[model samples]
Every structure is written in structure tokens, then in C-alpha cells.
Target: MTTAIGNPYLEGNFAPVSDEVSVNDLPVTGTLPPELNGRYLRIGPSPKGSGETGMSHHWFVGQGMVHGVRLRDGHAEWYRNRFVRGDVPEDSPNTNILAHGGRLLALVEGGGAPVSITPDLNRMSTWDADGALRAGFTAHPKTDPATGEMHSLSYLIRPGTEELRYVVMDATGKATHAAELPVSGVPMVHDMAMTATRVVVLDLPVTLSMDAMGRLAAGAPESGDALPMRWNEEHPSRVGVLPRGGTADQIRWFDAPRCYVFHVLNAYDTPDGSIIMDVVRYDTVFRDVFRGPADGPPALARWTIAPDRGTVSEQIMSDYSVEWPRINQAWAGRSHRYGWFGGTGPDSLRLSDDVSRDRGGSFEPGPLVKFDTATGEASAHHFGTGRVTQEPTFVARPGAEAEDDGWILSVVYDGTADRSELVVLDAADLKAAPLARVHLPRRVPFGFHGNWIADNEIGA
Candidate 1:
């Protein structure tokens, strides 16, 4: 029997044209070459989801050029267009685009090596010293700020068992080492994070008994019940930190819960040789599989490492309701402070005693919270009940910039009009009104990640 499926690509009334504007109905110029002097570069899949049989969704790299509007006296027009198209498949949720020195690195989802897009957004032709394709490949590549070297880790699933072997690569595209890791109940190696000096792998070692149709049969439901899943009295989560130059025996392991269902939203290195990782630890009894809330409002824990002494310390910075899970956090500045924003959800006061009755599910309007890392003092700025602000991208203003402050650019959802606006806030005082709100013609769909391209930069 054939089951009827709803069209996943249904169109909605999300796009809104800006008012106080004469060009009321400018058509969307799809997949066109970008103009020069554009400031922003965005990389994502083509509008159509990846379901077409033979054709692949075009991976787009777009540039936004800001121009003074002659029609609207004081306003400006930001023309965005795609400059490059690649057939790389983006099956995973996260893709990365980072500007390193003069070259742009594009990391697609599938198992290809990382691709290098030149300042012009065109794919580069040169291979690295190891003779690997420098462009149009896949791998998670992150550049070290101090040394400017690129590091990546890739893994392949073992043929007959639930295990994976990883290959670590350096800036010159050379495979430095290989090792095997047990995969219990966790997802594939597609979900991993890395720093300049270390690679962190999250794995679960429990085998799932399956039926004739290959569906999971009855087994222990909780991750903690998995035989090989690791947890300890202090950390209570399984984490493996492999140093870049260390031998297999020198690799360090820590216990930490899997916070999110199948992904690690963010992870970064700290100055004091610690790692801060965000995870969604499963709260089994309270979590609902179909319509239930997310697994956690995961906390950002500090994992301190003492290579010489062979020790690690895990400390939770802050934890909140599961409804308002904090996803991303960044160091604010010299004060050693950090600020983060929670996911969509209603105010805590509005949550009913019974969670099933709560209307909060996906992205509900939330607030931005700032914390003093040294003192653990925290404060929040809730935009409001109907207005949603999210995916804040913070940048330090150039020059002799304020050592303790930066600028935050976020997408604001104005519920009343069902439209979205770009809101810029002073990181120091988030409670203040946005410095500017550039009204958009439609809802910029919720996005995973973004980086700022300053105006004075060469490409812009």
C-alpha cells in the first residue's frame, strides 16, 4: 500500500515587502551573479529541498552589496546574489563558511573534503601540498586564530560493527593519524567538533537489537542504560579529547551527558586550556518523542585540561528551563564575560503546570542573556511576548574598540505583522532599543549559522 505524503515544499505567506518604499514588488532574482563591493557572504542549499531524483540542490554562496537608495531619500538597498554553485549534497543540518586571511573555506555536509572559495566566491583550482582537491570537497575545517592553520577530522563507519575509525588532517591536507572509536547509541561521525590542538568525539557504544525489517526492537531506552555508554560521578557524560600531537595512550576521556538529541550546537576553546561545549542532556521522563519538548536547556560546561598533570574539571556555568534551551555563547570581551541567547519559547510564567498543555514547541520568542564568567552573575533582556529575536551574530567593532563591548545583529520576528526585521543591539546594554531595524520584504527563514563581512574588507 502506498502512503500519501504531504508536500514538504509547501509555500507560505512569510515574505513581506517593506513599506515607505516605492519599489513595492521587486522580483526575487534567483541564482544570479552577485555585484562587486558586497559585504555579506551566505552559503546554503538552494530553496528547493534535496528530493529531486537526478538534479542536486545548488549550493549557493551569495554576496550582499549595500547601495544608497535614490527612490527612498535616506534608505539603502542591500542587493544579494549568488556567485558560486556546486553540486555538493547538504544532507546534514550544519554547513560552514569561514573567511581565513584572503581565502574562504566552505565545508559542506557530506563526506567530501573542505572546499576553498576565493575572495571572488569562485572555487579555487589549486590543491594543497598533499595533492587533495582544495575545493569542492567535504570536511569540518576550522582555522586556528593564532597560527592560521586549518584542522579537520573525518570518520568512516566500520563494515560489520557499530564503530567508526577517524582520520585527522592538518592544514596541508595531510592525514596525520587514524584511530577507532566505539559507537553505542549515538549518531554517526557527522556530529563531531574540533579545536586547533584537540579533536572531541561523542560516541555511544550500546547495540540496538533490530527486527526483520531492520527497525530497532525492544532495548534499553535511556542512553545511561546502554552497556558501553560512559558516565562518571562527577562529569556524568562520555567525551574523548584527543590531542593533536599525542599518542593513542595519551588521549584523554571525560564523562558528560549527551545534552541535545543528536548534535552538538556549539563548542570552543578557552584561554586557560579548557573546552566549553554545549549539549542537550536527555531528560527521559519529561521528554516526549512526538510532541514532547526538547531534551534539554543544556548548560555550557567548562572542561579544563592539564596535559602535564593528566586531569580534567567540568563545571556548569548556568542551567535553565528545558523550554528555553541556550544554543550559542561567546566571550564578550576583556572583562572575561559571556553572553548567550535561548531558543524560542514562551515566558516561564506562561508555562502551565502540565507540559502537554503548553503551546511551546519549536522557535518561540525568547531573550538574550549575559553572564559574568568570573562572578557567575547573569542578567537577561527578553524582547517581549510576541516579538522573537534569535541567531545573534556578535562582532567587535574595529579600531581602539571598547574592550568590554561589541555589536549584536539578530533577526527579529514581529508577530503582529508576521514579518521579520534585522535588529542591532549594543552588547553591553541589550535592554536598550535596537540601534537600527532594517525592515525586510519577507521572513528570512530561521537559519543555522552566519558570520559578518565588514565593509572595509577587500572583498566587500
Candidate 2:
């Protein structure tokens, strides 16, 4: 049970770790794969102070922290955690970290800019490399596997005015193209999907709070820059499809069902000229996020957007409460059979409590789930007892041939030991025994997305 007055985000396993440490030669269980030669890195919001809870506390807003574990030639070398640096209190950028332009970046949507970080897990600086990202960058920018190009659709919501930007960056990470997209009140477009020929945008019902806007104008104490985005009944939920490297004016808008999507599983074009977009659809958000999560649990669903009809249809793909969907990057912006997400079960909370600093925390990832789109079959690697998993990142073995031929790497919190470990599971057999478990000195509090940066991708 959460403390009567304590913020749910800061009280339990969700609580933030105060110290940043570096430890080499971490303890390992099982055998570390020799082919895994890179760093398993992840980032998320960590509260700068426990006192910043209550009416102002939010899982999405906090000091951006990066946690990383290095692997090379059958050994887990080191683990380091660092807070992304910026201007000061004015610069808390916690969201997702990714590799772009051959450099690693820490990104947060809605106002905080993307900050670059060293491969050794050190914060570099706020990246305006050539000044491509004028506003804010999205946490979920789609990286094209074929050309190594990154595509992003970002929205900035402040005291007044509203709009979205379409940005394209080459493999080296210089902004090649940028365009401004006009829109009504600020709508929460957290993630975007990409196909071989187009950029898929989600324009749902979650709108920025005007009441919060008014409060900010009156100089209310600033807790977070997000400023509370709430669900709007009057707003029409929709999706926008724009041709790749095209302007927003050419976008074809399609009416979508009354729902919200925080992340997309995958999307591609159908043979019949239709587009298949899979996403984690939420019933609502920011409804009561300050008190608790808004929706029960988001589910994986598929929406078929038919442009001729100007409408989108959805089908629930899995009944499981899932989020943070991932797929092989090679299959991204294209079709694939396998998909993965974090799942929860009946005894989820009970298991979470053991590792949690306190009782009564909110939703935490329970298991790593794998899905076969071709067969509609499901597989899971559940953390049996006294453990919880974070977003699983897929890493394909060198010269991998099959779709699920690599390994699923995730940061796991072991309640019994009260420490975190990075577990590696064969993607083809997620339920099988972990290939290896690299132990961490401290816990990796529940966090957002990250990716495995291969040796070649990291600068020397």
C-alpha cells in the first residue's frame, strides 16, 4: 500500500536512487555471451528529491538519469549511472536515450531538449548539433534500419501557441530537413511510427490543460515542465499519415476511435494499399495521474488506417496489460512477425513489493512478453519471485539470420537481494533460462526506453 501522503512514484520501487556510482568487474551468473559486444544502456526519470511528491509528482517528469552496463568478449565490464546535465533546475530531461549521428543522446518530449552522453555513461551537453532540434525532440524517434536515418515528429506546448515539427536527420546526425505543422490546442503526441514511405502520427484526445496554463501565467510554483496534459472529451481523436520527407500540408488525416496511444508496437503498409499500425492504446491519461495512473492497463491493439475512407479501425491483439513494445530494428518501417512488450500478471504487485523500497507503489513491469504476429501465439519470461523487469531491448547476434535470432536484454530488480541485474534471454526462446545475469551494485528504479549500442556504433 502506498503511503497516505507520500508520492507513489517516490515511495516504492519507483523511488529514485540518489547516488551515481561506477563499478567494474560486476558479479555475473550463468555465462555471458561472447558475441554481445556493446553497452546495454537505458534512461528514465529519477526524482531529484523525495520531497517533490504529492500533487506535483509524476512518473513522466523527474531528473533524467542514464544507467548502463558494458559487455564485451564474454565479460560484464562495468556499470555506471549519471544524471543528464543541462542548464540547471531549468534542465531536467528524463525520458529515453538513443544513438543518433554516431553519438548517444538523452531525450525528453514536451520542452526539455535532448542531451548528448558519452558511451562511458557520462553526460556531454545539450545537443543542438547544427541547431536542427530548435524546439524539443521526441523520446520515440524512428530510426530507419536501411539508411540509418532518424525521423521524428515533435510537439512543443508552452504558455501559449501550439504546433508540431517534422524533422529528419542523416546517419551522421545532422538535421537534413525540418518543417512546422500547424494544429489546434496542444495534443500529447508522445510517439510516432514510420513505414518505408511515410511517417505515422498519432493525434489523440489527450490535450494540454488550459487551467494549468492559466495557473502558470499567475506564477504558480513550477514543479514540472509538462504542466499537466489532460484528456479532452470535446477533442476529436485522429491520426495523420504523411509521406516520407514531405511537409505537413500533404498529410492525410483519418478519424480514429476515442482512445490514446502512448507507444506504437509497429506499423507497415499492406499489399492492398492499407496501413497496419499496432499501438498500446490507453483509455485515458492525465485524468488522475497525480493521484494514480489514469487507465486500468493499456493493451496491444492493431489499427487499420484506410485513407480512402478517412477512418481507422482497431482490433485488440492481446488481452494482456502491455506497454513499451519493441521489435527488431531491421523489421521496423516494414513488416515483421515477432513483437515484444512488458506484461503484468495476477501476483505482479506482490512480487513488486519485495524489491520496492516501500509498499503500495503503482504499476511496474512484471514480465518480458514475446508475440508472433503470424501465428497469434504468445510467450513470456516471467520474473518468478522477488523480481520485476524493465523495458526489454532486442539485440541481434552478429550476422543473425532469423527474426528472433538475437537476445532480449533487460534490467531486472531482485527483491531478495535488493539489487538490479541485467538478464539476457535468447529472443527465440524467451522462456528458457537466462544466458547470463550481470549484477549491479544498486537498483535500476523503474524507467523508460533504451537500446543496445553495438561496438561499431560507439565512438572510440
Candidate 3:
């Protein structure tokens, strides 16, 4: 069964799977690494029932479903898919998943509480750090590798909410500090960046739209069932750099160039008192389509924010279009040498209106790219054609000292076979063939971020 006739997001690899099946002893094509002793879990919108269709159905509004692959003792142990059951299951966290603080968490942005799940991917309950999350948690949280504390910038999307919160969670997964930073508009804060001493807040141009809300409330045809956020040209784009646990008054604001950023690769503080950040940048989003992002083929860019001069210098790091940029978690909030991303094209950027007319792109699969930031050189591994690759999560080799000494795990969907496989590549050699491939029973739909939760990290 398919979704709305021409809704691209509801068709192809973006389509939702109806069954929640568990299959053990999956077939493996190559030798699995014995050290990969844990789970590779990914979560995304998998809408329930065929009742959801039409222009109102958006890509980001589907139910949360998690797809997991377990590896232990050099074997593909099992593969499972389960729904993140909630009071309103459709609104459950579906953007990212990770094991932190001794519990596995499914996460989302825009004022949603983290849904704690068992290590095996079953929903438990809404987690608020023993009731520390007053406003909610963000999908993207930066962990301080030096201190083991996780930090994020969270915001509630509403008609009158005019502030964003800076939250910190200790190594034990308890909410340690949270501060409400006042702002003029309720911006869509998808991700945040952190350094040794401060947290970077993105106050871009995309904001909550009351007009779209009124249209949806009145059941207008043009008002789709997506989040009501639009590109507010009047809203000034800026970045607030504040001390890790600092209050609003302590935040130093700088005017940023007009643009929107959905993901930050990494950030760190320089000796000159400037914050250096790398991010996937979009020119403008939510302008014509009320659904998901319909802007540029997002490019990797770097921003140098000088607090002393109160200015920001923006530089497009590469002309190559990409998304879901990731780095070594061990180097989080610090200088890094390598970054991995899924390649995209201009055809992938389309609006809902275009999708209805059969003009949207499927975000077709491109090469998996590895960027050498220090040398401005890149290498790629193309998985032929018609194979969609998601974000490449980097897992370092045990006791490895080099930054690129690791493996890159990504979920790739083979269109010809109508199935998916977990591809493991050597980070040091992107052009080389995959190290291993674990074949699965079904195609894991294109989705957002996830991680390699080792046994030690989860105490499993």
C-alpha cells in the first residue's frame, strides 16, 4: 500500500513499512568485525495505516519506527523493527537514536521529550532527566569528549514562545544545567554547536508561522499537515555564543549572513577568542513548501565568529552538495581531521506542490564522501546506481589514536533488489570496497541520524 498518489516522500525508499518483524542470524557477505559488539540503530518517520494521505501528509509528521541491526562475536546476530509507542504514537521521537546515560533514547526536535527505550528498541516512557526538561530536548546534542557532558539548544515552537533554552546533561544522563535564553522570534533550532567553554545557539531566519497555523486550524486546502514554519525574511539571522552554563545576559550575539543550517559538523574555540564551526548550510527553506526543507542542495560551509569584532565570516568549504555531516564523536567540540556525508543533488530539493505533480526527486543515492578538512581534499565511494545511502556514522577502532582510524557504517537501499544492507567501509580508504555487508529482509527507508552504541557504552 502506498501513500498519497504523488507525495514523493511517501513513495520510493521514503515509503513506510507496515510490518514490525524480527529476524535472527541474518546473512552476511563479508566478515563482520568482532569488535563491533553492539547495535546500529536508526529511527525515522514510519506512518501507521493507509488513512494518512493527500497534500496534508508531510515527510516529518509520520509515526516513529526504529530499525536495528545487532552485531556480536563477528556475526550478524539479528535485525528488528519496532514502533516507538507513545500516547500519540505519531508524535514520538523519530529523528535520531543513541545510547547515553545507560539508556537508549529516541529523539526529536521542536519541544518533544526524549523517549527512553530499552537496549533492544522497545519504548519505555518519556525521559526528562528526572523532570529537568521543562520545555523539551533537541534531536542534536553535542557531547563534550573531554568532560563527557552533553549539551544542546532547545526551543518550543508555539504562537507566543519567544525564547530558546540551553540544556546540559551530565555523563550519567541527568540534566545538570538549563538556562532560558530570550529571543525576539521563535526560531527553528534544529542543531547546536559546543566548544570547551561555550555553547553556540543558531538563531536563523526560519521561524514559526501563525498564518499557516490559522490556515491549518481552519482546514484550508493549502495548509498541509506539516509543521508551520516559514522563512521569515524580517527575522534577523544571528548566532549567540554563551558560556556553557551562562545566562541570557551573558550571551554574546553576532549577526550571521542570511541562511539556515540544519546540522553542525563540529565546533571549537580558537586561541583568538573566535568560535569556528562547520555546518551544512541551506540558502533558504520552508519558503514555498510547508513540509520538509525545499531549498538548496545543502553545501558544507565554515563560519568563523569573532566575538571581539562582533562579526561572522562565512566561507563555503566545498561546492559539493551534501547532508547529514558527521565526525568522530571522540573529537566532538574540538578540532577534527575528517568528516563523512551522503551526497545529494539539485533535483532532491523540491516542494510538496512539485511532488504532487510528479516533479520531485527521490534524493537519489550518490557517493559516500570523506573530507580531509586540513588539506581540502576529498575521496568518495560510489555504490553504483540506484543504491540510496544514508548518513555515515564513524566508529573508531578500539584504542586507535588516529582520527581516521575507524569504520563508516551506513544503511544503503538497493532499488533493483528492493532490499537494504548495512555497509561498513574503512574510514582511511573511502575508495576501497566495503569491509562488510549485512543483508536485511527489507529496505530501511531513508532517515535521519543514528550511532554505533558499543557494548561498553550501554553496559550490555
Q: Scored by CA lDDT, what does every candidate get? A: 0.40, 0.78, 0.81
* Candidate 3 lDDT over residue span 289-380, tens digit each: 55566554577889999999999999888656678999988888888878998876522222223332232433444568888889888677
Weakest 10 consecutive residues, lDDT, candidate 3?
347-356
Model 1: per-residue lDDT, tens digit, 1-460? 1111221111121111221122232232221112212233333322331232111111111111111111112232442323233334322222455554454555543233444555544334322325433222333444444454544434332224544445545544455655555544323333455554576765433122222113112432232121122211222345667775444465666654434323444456667776655433333312332112232233445544444445555666655332222222232111134544543345422223344224332323356655555577655666665676545655564442443366665556666776656555676777776665656554543333445554343343
Prediction 2 global C-alpha lDDT:
0.78
Best by TM-score: 3
By lDDT, highest first, what's the ranking?
3, 2, 1
- Tens digits of per-residue lDDT, candidate 2, 1-460, equal 1332445566656777778899999989999889988898888877664434444566787788899999988999999999888755546578888787778888888866888787887647777657778677888889899999899988877645467888999899988888777777788889998999888888888878877666556756333323567778888888889888888689888889788888987899987778999888877765645333434566678899888777789888765666789998999989888997777534332222433222243665688889887877878788678787868899987898899999899988877877889999999998899999998988888888888888788664
Q: Model 1 segments beyond 4 Å from truth?
A: 1-38, 41-85, 88-94, 110-141, 155-186, 189-197, 204-237, 245-250, 261-293, 303-314, 321-336, 347-365, 400-404, 455-458
User: What is the C-alpha local distance difference test score of candidate 1?
Assistant: 0.40
lDDT of 3 at 295: 50
TM-score of each: 0.62, 0.93, 0.94
Q: What is the lDDT of residue 175 in candidate 3?
A: 80
**How does model 1 score by TM-score?**
0.62
